[model samples]
Target: MNPIDPQHRNDWLLRAEPVEGVERIEAFFQAKAYAMHRHDTYAIGRTLAGVQSFNYRRSTTHSLPGQTMVLHPDEPHDGHAGTGEGFRYRMIYVQPALFQEVLGGRALPFIEGGVTGDPRLWAATDALLQQISQGLDPFEQGDALAELAHALAAVAGTAPARSTGDFASVRRAREYLDAQCHQAVSLESLELAVGRDRWSLSRDFRVFYGTSPYRYLTQRRLDAARAMMLRGVALAQVAASAGFTDQSHMTRHFTKTFGIAPARWLRILNGARATEILRNTAA
Candidate 1:
C-alpha cells in the first residue's frame, strides 16, 4: 500500500515497558500512518526495514538502516512508511532527568535534521538499544545505562575547556533543579546550590546535559502533559497540571512540539474510533 499523508499517519501507539527512563515502543507503520506526536523522552531509533517517512521541524524526513534518528525532546514529529513495504522501528524514550545525570543542566545536543553518523553517538547507543529490543542481564542494564550516559555526553558535548568532569558542583545543581522542577528556579539560586558560579554551571549543564535548564523544565512539563492527555484529561486541566500558562499556550507549544493538538491526543488515547477514522487513510 502507498503511504498516507503526514497529517494522519500516527493514529496509534503500541507501548512497552519503559527502559530506564525511556518508554519503549515498537510501531507497525502503515505505508504511512503515524500522526504528529512528540514525547518528553529523547526519541532515538533505528528503522528495522523499509523507508520510514516523517514530517519534522519544517521538512519531511526519511530514515533508513544505520541512520540514528535523534528527535530532541519537545519537538513536534510524526511517522509512517514511505514505501510499499511499510516500516518497523524500535524507539527508546530517555527522560531529560536521566540525560541530566550525565551532563547536568546544560542545553541538550540537537543533531541537525534528526539524523547523525557520529561514531561516538553510534557506539554509545547501539548496545543499550540492542538490550532494550532483546534481553539483557539486570546488572548489564545498569552498566549500559552509565556507559550510555557518558557516550551520549561524548557525542553531544563540546570538549570542556577545563577538561574535568567536576562531579560535586554539577551534581548539586542537578539535585536542586530536580527537586524544584515544580518551582521557579533562578540562576543565583542554582549557583549557590551547585557551589559554582552561575555561568560555569550553566555552561557545564549545556556541555553535559544535551539541553538547557529552561528547555529541560519545558520537557518535563510536556512529558507530564503527554501522560495526562493519554488518560483523557481536559485541555485546560492538562495545561495547568503540566505547568503551562493556559490551554491556548499549551496548544501552541503542544502542536509545535508534538505535531498534534491535545484534543486529537486525548481522542486517540481513548480509543475513540481512530481505527475507523484512519482506516481509509491507512496505507
Candidate 2:
C-alpha cells in the first residue's frame, strides 16, 4: 500500500504480498517502532522523510532522505524516529537465497555502518523501493534483483570467490527444501535426495544459500504462516498448517523474525487497510 494520509498522524505500515522471495513495505512511525530483533533477510531501503534511526552493530545510526540503509541478515537492530517529527521510509526485504542465485556461493555483501550515501546502491534499489502498491512483474523483479546484488557487492568492495564446492548438488537440495518446507525435513533425508553427504551438504548449503538448511526451512514455513494469517486463518491453525508444533512455537519464531507479535502486526496492517479504504472513499 502507498503512504496513508499524513494528517491522520498515527503509526501505520503497509506491506506488499511477498513475491518470489522479495517483500516490500512502506511505513511511518512517530517514535519507537520495533524492539531489537533479527531476521534472515537483507533489509534495504531509503528514508522518505524525517530522521529514521536504528541501533545496529552496537551503535545507533540514522538515515535521512536520499540515504540508503543496508542491514545485513540476522543482525540485531531496533528502530525509532531520530526526532519528534517521526519518520517515513520504504524497505524491501530480500531473502539471501535470491542474492546467492546471483553471487553464486560467495559471501553476502555487507555495507558498513548499516547506512550509506552511495549513489550506486541508491540507483539499484530505486526500482524495488517504489510505492508498495505498484508491484513489480516477475521479469522486472528479476532484473531489479540482479542489479541490486551486483551493486551490493561493488559498494561493499567484496571480491568474487572462486567456485569451490558442489553447487549443483546444493541447488538440488535447495529445490527439494523449497518443495517440502511444509513437512519435517532432516539432513539425512536431504542427503538421500541430493546424493550428497549430510555434513558436506550442510556446509555447502550455508555457503551457497547464506543460511543453514534448518533456518531456510523455518523461514519458508514462516512465509506460509504469514500468507495464511493474512487470509484470516486462526493463529493456532496457521501454526499447525505451517508445520510448527503449536501456536506458541510459531509465536516465538514470528516475534523473533519480525520484531513484533502476530497480533500487533495484524493490527498495524488492518489499520493501513482501513486508512486506504477511507482515502478511497474520500476520493
Candidate 3:
C-alpha cells in the first residue's frame, strides 16, 4: 500500500517518532511546508512518493521517489511539495558524531546540493532507513552507521590528504556539551575541560564535528526539547526545562531548526495518531 496517498488527501499529514538520537518522520505536505532554517545534524532520508522539493545550497532541488537526500550539518534549507499533488517522504536526522566515529578525525563528507542518486549510498543506508516499526539493535545500528559513513565519504570523492584533527580535545568538548546541555556552558568551561583555547577549539570542532561549539550546545538543547515535546509536555515548560531563556526564544529556534513551530509539530503528531486510530477502528 502507498503509505502516503497524496492525491487522496486534501491537507497535510505528518508523523514522526524518535529513535535513539535520530528523528524518523513520514510526512505529506501540500504547498509550502517549512521556512528557511538550519540544523546541527545531517538530515538524511528518501523521498517516498510524488515530488519532494526543497531549497538547498542556493538552489531548488526536486527529489523523486527512490532518491536520497543528504543535507549537510549547519546548512540552511527549506521544504515544500514539488507538484500540485503534493509529496510524501521519510527522513532521519543523524548526528555528525556518529559519522565522526567511523571517519576518525577526518572532516565530514560534503555532498553538494543535498541529494544523491548513488546506489552505493542506497545500499549502505538500507538497514538504517527501513520502514519497519521496530527500533534497531545497538550492534545492528552501529554497523549501519559505520557503513553509511564510509559510503558517504566514498561517494563524495577523495578528500585531500590532511592531518587528523585534535580528536581528544574535540571529544572532550562534545562530552561537556552532552552533560551540560541544560545549563549555560561557557567557552571558558569548554576550554578548561578540553585544555584548548576557545578560538582554536571552535575551529577544530568545525573541522572534525561539522559544527561550532555554541551551535552544538544549542542543537543538544533542541534535541532535549524535542524529546520532552514528544512526551506531550507543555510548550512553556519544555522551553524552560530545555535551557531556553523563554518560550518565545525556544519557539524561534525550534521553528528555524525543525522548519516548523513546536505547536505545529505536536499537532502533526496528534493528527498522525488520530489517523492511525481511525484506520485501526475500521480494520
Candidate 4:
C-alpha cells in the first residue's frame, strides 16, 4: 500500500514489529476504528491528539492527549474518534504473562474508568511509548515492563502476591505449554509433566497467570500463526503449521482474538511497512 496521504482524512494504523509479550501500534482515526471486542491482553496507551473515545465497561470514556488509558484483559470495548477533528494515539498490547512475571502471581491491576491522568503512569509508559521507529533494546523493554507493572499495581491498590500458590509448578506448566502448543495437549499430559493435580494446577495457573491454561495455550498458537502470516505464508499453511484444525478454524480464533480478519490484519501490517519504507527513502 502507498504511504497514507496526510491530507486525506482517512484512518490508518501502523504496527511495530512484535516484541516478546508485547505489540505496539500508532493509529489515527476519523471515525469508528473498532467494534466491540475483547482480547486477553492489557491494552495500555496514550492519546496523542484530538479526543480518543471508547465505550468501555457500560460507559463511554474520552481521553485527551497526555492521558493514560489502561484497559484490562478481556474487557469489552470499542473505540472511535470523539470529535469531528478525529483522534490519534499510540498503544501497546501486553500479554498478561509478562505482568504476571513482574507481580509474581498478584491480581492484574485495574485502572477504573479506563483512562488516567496519573503522573506515575505517564512517566512509566514514556520509555515504551516512544516513536514506533525508535525501538527499545531487550533490556530497556524489560525495565519498562517492570516499571509499568509496578505502577499499575500501585495505582490499582493491589498488593503483591502473598506466596500462596504453587508458583514453581505453575511456572513449569506454563513453560511446558509454551513448548508444546503446536501439539494436542491434555490436562492429563500437563499433570504428568508438571507433577500436579489437574484441579490444583488449573486454580494455581489462573492465580498466577490471570488466565486459564487453555487460554494460554491457545494464545501461544495464535502468536505463532501471526508470525507466520507476517512472513507472507499462505493462510492454510499457517493454520496447519500453528496447530489449528484448518484454515477456517484458525480464522475463527484469529478474528475472535483480534477483532479483525487475518487478511485485513495483514493488509494493515503491510501498509505500515510500506509507509515506513517511504519515510526512509524520503529521509
- Candidate closer to the true structure by lDDT (higher is better), 2 or 3: 2
Better of 1 and 4 by lDDT: 4
TM-score of 1: 0.64
lDDT (10s digit) by residue, model 1, range 60-142: 88888777888876577887677876676667777766766555544456677887667776667776567332665556656
| Model 1 spans with C-alpha error above 4 angstroms | 1-10, 17-20, 28-41, 54-61, 65-67, 71-81, 84-86, 96-140, 147-167, 186-192, 195-198, 269-283
Which stretches of model 4 miss by more than 4 angstroms? 1-8
Clashes of 3: 0
Give the per-residue lDDT of model 2 (tens digit) for 11-80: 8999988888899999999999898888878999988888889999999999989899999987889999
| Model 3 TM-score relative to the real fold | 0.93
The lDDT of each candidate is: 0.66, 0.88, 0.82, 0.86
Give TM per candidate.
Answer: 0.64, 0.93, 0.93, 0.91
User: Model 1, 28: alpha-carbon shift in Å?
Assistant: 4.6
* Tens digit of per-residue lDDT, candidate 4, span 232-262: 8999999999999999999888877777788
Better of 3 and 4 by lDDT: 4
Per-prediction tally of clashes: 23, 0, 0, 0
Off by over 4 Å in 3: 1-17, 158-161
- Worst lDDT window (10 residues) for model 1? 1-10
RMSD of 2: 2.5
Error of 3 at 56 (Å): 0.9
